[model samples]
Target: MMIVCAGLSAVVAGGAGAQHVAVSVQVSSDRQFVPLQSYVQGEVDGKLLFFCGLSDMGLHVFGQGAFPAKNFSRQIVMVDRATGAVTTGTTDHLPLATRQAMTVTAPTAVQYGSILYMYGGYGPDLENPGDYFTRALCTAIDLVQVKNALQASQPVPASAFTHTECVAGKVAGAGIVKLGDRFALICGADADGEYGSAPDPEYTNVVQIFDRNVSYVNPVETLDDGQGFFSPMHRRDVNVLPVRMPVDRAGFVVVCGAFESGIFLYENPLIWGEGDAVPYEDNEFIQHIGGYEGPIASLYSASHDRNHLLIFSGLSGYEYIDNEFVWNPAAPWTRQIVNLHVDGGVFARELVLGEMPWPLTNAKLVLENTLPKTTDGQVLVDQLPFGQPILLGRIYGGIAAEKQGSVSPTYASDAVLDVYVTVTPEGPVEVRPSAFSRVRGLHVSGGLSDLLQSDDLRLVTRPDVFRTSAVPPVQIQVVGTSPLQNPSEIKFTVESRASANNISQRVRLFNYDTQKWEQVDARTMPLSDTTIVVTISTDPARFIDDATGEMKALLQYNALAFTIAPIWQAGQDLTMWTIVP
Candidate 1:
């Protein structure tokens, strides 16, 4: 399948049938593989066979509920990027500890030259803590042997891998990136056990470079901790994508992740470089980009200097309320297929709405377009102006949540997507959201009716009309004084002219995950002239079970509003206001 997105001018000049750079996605009908096992994956010889991950085949999210020992999978899953084919086999033959080190939930992992190196992740305790009980264990997968065995159709032996047990430096969830030879692992903590609240001594915002030749990681510098505000220095669950400079040099762009040090936890994509202890420039490029944010995947187009980040669906952080920071660990997972133009080490985000699947967090994208014959083939970076539809890569095995909380039980996604990027002459494409129009009747309604009065729904208030007959409950859609990327509780209060018994109010909320409107239950105030307030929110408790990140976009796109009316009596009227506090 091919989807085209081109500039209007280019298309008009080229006439109909003109093509431009476009992207499309297709899920194979017959390829439903049970991917209960989740793992950090990398392309080996351009194939996805190098990995260390496990998913509980049962019905639970990673850190939630009891850890199921029986279904823990330690396997090398190879996904053919060209055809969207996934193949897996148990790597359980390796030492149990090595497998566990690689199987920890949301570990900082990367792959290089037939070796999958994983560091710092949350999991069961190991005796070899950096001498302490920790999940900061590190392990390496020797894909050279695994690949040979697979080519021969022979079972892999346990001796084919290497394990580096815990140390004070052994950390989980640290953000890491590789320049040439050195792997700079950044900000993470030493945890005692699984899903515990906090870490003992937070791993200082230090840069630990693990050179390929060195046996141990060497600490270089520590970053200044941010006090009164948020900083990326002391953060975990962060991801970095590769970028190329206009010159010969290239580096990684650190995407935003979850940070708990502040009163509120959220992500703001920041770019920094190893060349300088300072970042490219302190900037947060806001785009339509979506992701599970932390446990995410990225593909860089060296030719285009563009990084395609696959932000699968996952939880979001909190919004600052009156004085408190309200967080939603299970912010609905919305599908985000975004990219960034990297130049001079700076990032410019491009929020593109494309033909994509639901966001898959904790998922891995493997490039399969490289030469297939050689074991060490050249890496193929996606280039625009496909001239025709071309397969870009494949996404396999990640968790898709059905609930708001990451701790809640979630089933593994069973399908894999094949991304086809095409460049046509259609010109640069822009999509405008459809105009909203609707008005409510007597009972209850949602959609455009809840929005504020417009030219379509003109509000001509006749104060004199209340002198005789009855007044109707008013529904209003609100656009605020300022725009909000992450919003907290939005409140709607009605000052009723009648007795408290005559007050009634309702709201229509859009649930992106379910693609439905949820009704907010209304209630009356205690006073005679009641002031009834109902809050519309993204709080997991207030939203539908599986709603996702798209809700924020829907609300921001001039679609947030609610209704207020008199339910018990006919001769009553009310005044209303909306507040996002």
Candidate 2:
């Protein structure tokens, strides 16, 4: 039986009878002599093998495109990229007739010319962790054609590899990618329940790299073993384990959800199982740039930089909820919450409080295609090794008594309290909030319903607090009138309102020490119709101006307000206000 292989072609219709056909000849075949492994598109020696289908006989060339090549019981004809033609190849090229009876499970394959590489997956003797048979994989190279058959096809003797224990069943999971001068097969998880039974700390931590011209792959010898790349964890039941080859990174490979612990990367070849696997102990491993509430579901590397990874929502195992964060390998992954003033989108159109932007793509081109490109706010400008001090705009909305007591006005009094503000972005991009300006007064809405009214100037009021800081639950100094004639009680409160035309308003208090805004407490009266009165017994010398001999109040109350409105397009019509007296 003669094996037929041909490259695919394309025809372009031009003026009149003039036609152009783009033809690229493939002197090789995708058919291989081994069971299929995972399939991927890659360049071998600068040649693009468009459609690569896997079979135990040999990696066959079905065409030079993404052509469906499953079900061997049917005819085995591959298309040619050069002539836009299809021709029959070898009759024994595939074992599709009896593929269902094959004992191997999770069979996958990838080909570069005649060289077909098959790796990891369960086959035949399926057993539990204890009784499971661990078989490795078989690697075959150079199944070139013996003769150039027709002008349209090439002929090669049929070849197939026998399954071996090295790559047989021990191959639990694998993904393939061609890099530089070799093919890298990332082997992971447990196939036969070995790790599930007694539990091995190094099961999913292993990776194998195969060089060009090698027929067999030795997991221990092929590539770098992940040393400092993994976080150690006790073995347990695992299901729905999924891995992906993110495109942002040029040459790096990352695997996630081994036992639902965390994501691991091969920053350098042979990185797994080498140095300390414990993230806390191993300083060489890529430090987590930030902490995410849940395990990562997807990670996208920057198109230009490999050091940055964009993480998307995934389960934290606790809530099965999705959280996002940007992970920089150079720094320890720390979790941060950034309050953003949002208008509309998949995420709610309000200020995202106690939340941060999830890093998932290359920072270089994140907002390149947005309506208008933003340079400063949309991108990360600086990095604080220990997180440098930043100015967070604050709006004082309310206040609370730390401990109930007859409050007195004195710098040494334990009742001395601090203030803070939480500044959230009004849009998706980055923003730097300015300090509260007395010139920029606060504008309070009559009520929640007042916010729904458009062009209703009467519904807007200017009685809100105004303040500034660069921290969450921001902090401020509470100053009031001094030398009180009679003791009275004062109450402070913050209320927020949102509507469709002009909705998405929020308020939160601040903490002086932590330098951030405390969650807003709205029950306190924002502006009580009645003033809080306090008794004063201090010496007149302390309150009276030395030159004027008149008592004056040193402390003052602060207020702030914010409003957002949508006028057809997104991120338009917004107002911010702050007041202090």
Q: Estimated TM-score per prediction?
A: 0.57, 0.29
Q: Find the candidate with the highest lDDT and give its number.
A: 1
Predictions in order: lDDT = 0.45, 0.25
Span of ten consecutive residues with least summed lDDT in model 1: 552-561
Model 2 residue 221 lDDT? Answer: 42
Give the best candidate by TM-score: 1
RMSD of each: 19.9, 27.2
Q: Per-residue alpha-carbon lDDT of model 2 for 1-581, expressed as tens digits?
A: 11111221111111221111111111123221112222222223222221122333221122221112341222222323323233434534434322211233333344555665554443323222123333455533232331123223654223333334444214443444444344445544444432224334235444445555654454324443345334332111111111112331123223222333333322211112222232122223332221221111111112211121222221111211145333332212222222211111011111112222221110011111111111111222112001112222111101111221122111101111111121111111111111122112233323222212132322222322222212211112111121111112112222222222222222333323344543322222232121222222333223222332222111122222232222111110111111110
